[model samples]
Target: MLASFDIGALGHSFWALTISGLTYGSIYALVAVGYTLVYGVLRLINFAHSEIFMLGMFGQYAALMMFGFAPQGDAYDMGVAQTLMYLGLAMIGGMVVSGAAAVGLERVAYRPLRRRGAPALVFLITAIGASFVLQEFVHFVLPKLTNNTLGGLNAQQPIRLVSPSTQFTIFGATVTNVDIAIVVSALALAFATDRFINGTKFGRGIRSVAQDPVTATLMGVSRERVIMLTFLIGGVLAGAAALLYTLRVPNGIIYNGGFILGIKAFCAAVLGGIGNLRGALLGGLLLGVMEMYGQTVFGNEWRDVVAFVVLVLVLMFRPTGILGESLGRARA
Candidate 1:
């Protein structure tokens, strides 16, 4: 059996791994927020959410193709202005597609069940079923629909709009333009979401529903509307995360691309406090850094195992997470 740990390599790559981990964690943070928000209000796992993120990936790719980008063997090099435009457009495309898909999912998959007073286990099964349905639809139906132009159970070609060239060194670790963009954009979006959940009237309504749906309904908060909004917010954030994720893994936008990352994002949400927005952000960043450290210490093959182990340990010790609180306690 291979030795379980290797400390020497870790010490050598500490700074580089730290920087890269932060970049990866930022993407997780964005996706985690979606999981956190929907859970906060609905108290549902929304397993099909991974599919929403996957749709965002396809959405942005479709947008890029519409903008005249084509697959090539080598990465595309573009000016900063052009790159920024493409990035903005792709993110927007992703956000729109994901947000719409989420709403449709609510309207179609969960709404009827909710109206019929379905049990939690039933909802869980429905979510999983919806997830597979979306995946299969993309893998099988999309190819025929597009005349084999879009989908076919294969990894999509790389979208190389932005080159990940090193822009500067931070604490002896190289930071690329993509890294800066991912972190800054994710932080900005996270902050905005935090404010939306904790400071606004709508935010108050969401918290009220989370705390006591019947009371909120009696107070004139539309429960149905809140649920729809929650899904929309989660989907939009997932879509943003999808673009950032593609930036990190240029060729990773496959039909099942979101499954593993989505699970990690959910783990981040749970690690931080399942129903807490800021907690999800904290959990994501921590998980990313820890995963990198684990990879360095135990080799790349153990990267994911390390993350899951951390999750199990965290749950065993501090089940409420680092910033333990539900959405109701967010502003409290």
Candidate 2:
């Protein structure tokens, strides 16, 4: 039961849940955009995106371990410069590693089947199988291969990279230290992505390839390269999501926790309309607000149920989702 429903704790918990849901939904949107991006061009859901996210988390953990995650109490006096440097390295390492793994998954798993003209249903099966394989990969193979079981995974004091004890209030919502970090970080990423897709030459190449691969190739666009970069960007986004999510929850054991979020995120993407970035963001933000508001009205225990309930209702009314574009077409 959420203390929010009780008058004594109402404001704090309500606002906490509200901001928490927004942060989660934003992270989910990042993962969902991956699914939508791949689906946009290939018309296939890259269910392995969850694995990409999982690996991203693990990748950062690995780097953190290498750099020595700060000790508990006297982690004091850690310079902002050092902290930022470590965070930057972890993020870059996570993104690059995850992006590489994503591409590898594409080339190794799907590309051959696609070449053989595998049916969409078969591809669906492959996606599921890929997911399970990835789960197993993280659970057993990665440990065995590296000969190092990740310690302190569920430790009480999970690492916090950038913690500014600055709180703010807005629209009856209380924002916390991590809340600001998550929101600002996500906004920055989103803004940069907008600029990249709208301003850069490579972005146009991606758009061209996405709209029509054959036509793009005829017009001197490298379909292969664009597809590769699409996955790269997808992986990068998943990595970004990993940092935000890891900081929020802080104590997940298995790497594939991204699976749950990925499912919800993919749902969000479809709810808004797959292949539409703006739609993905809109659906994610709306879904977040709905989830938090639902928790506020009911109890936090019903958050997931509430979210899906709203989604079901929305789908019942607009079966093609809010933006009304089905499958590959970008929705308005």
Runs of candidate 1 exceeding 4 Å displacement: 1-4, 330-332
Q: Which regions of candidate 2 fall more than 4 Å away from where they truly are?
A: 1-13, 70-77, 151-157, 163-166, 171-173, 324-332
Q: What is candidate 1's CA lDDT for residue 67?
A: 94
Q: Which has the greatest TM-score?
A: 1
Tell me the TM-score of model 1.
0.97
lDDT of 2 at 308: 86
> lDDT by residue for model 1 over 218-299, one digit each (tens)?
9999999999999999999999999998888888888898888889998899999898888999999999999999988887
TM-score for all predictions?
0.97, 0.87
- Best candidate (score: lDDT): 1
Residue pair clashes in candidate 2: none
Task: Give the per-residue lDDT digits (tens) of candidate 2, residues 207-229.
Answer: 77677778889999987777788
User: Clashing pairs in model 1?
Assistant: none
